[model samples]
Target: MTTNLTPAKTSANTVSADEGLFKPGSKLKHKKSGGFYRVVMLANIEANLAPAYVYESLQNQNFWIRPQAEMEDGRFELVSE
Candidate 1:
């Protein structure tokens, strides 16, 4: 039997799909901390399949992940795409 491999959608009903906002290598800045980061890619949480953004810190090169909704909730401003 064939098995479906498609990933599940996010559980957030209010948040829209992450499209045309940013792409891989896009630069962003945190509004509160003024820290800068670069977009690595869009990822999903393995446990719940929640959409998340995979990014890297420009200051220390540490990678981080945040839910897609929070990432677009005015906390992070796009610096360059």
Candidate 2:
């Protein structure tokens, strides 16, 4: 877990693993997972990574703390406003 991922922010693949790109009120869709989520909080950067708290189910009002690596591989696409 010694990845030097800090300062490695990027918007590659449209699916962002870069938590810095996610803002509150921003919505994201995972192309592969078919999961749609909305960012509800700012990134909590720890070490070289940040976890973006996002809402996935509106019915449950539940959220998932997604790490930048998962997010990047989540195949997420920003839902344009």
Query: What is the number of backbone collisions in each predicted candidate, taken in the order shown?
Result: 0, 1
lDDT of 1: 0.75
Candidate 2 per-residue lDDT, tens place, 25-53, comes to 67787787666677665454455444545
After the best TM-score superposition of candidate 1, give how far the Cα of residue 3 lies from its true spot, in angstroms: 31
Candidate 1 C-alpha error for residue 70, in Å: 0.5
What local distance difference test score does each model get?
A: 0.75, 0.55
The model with the greatest TM-score is 1
lDDT, candidate 1, at 76: 92
Clashing pairs in 2: 17-72
Encode model 1's per-residue lDDT on 1-81: one tens digit a residue: 222232335455322235527677799999999999988777677777667777889998888989888998999999898
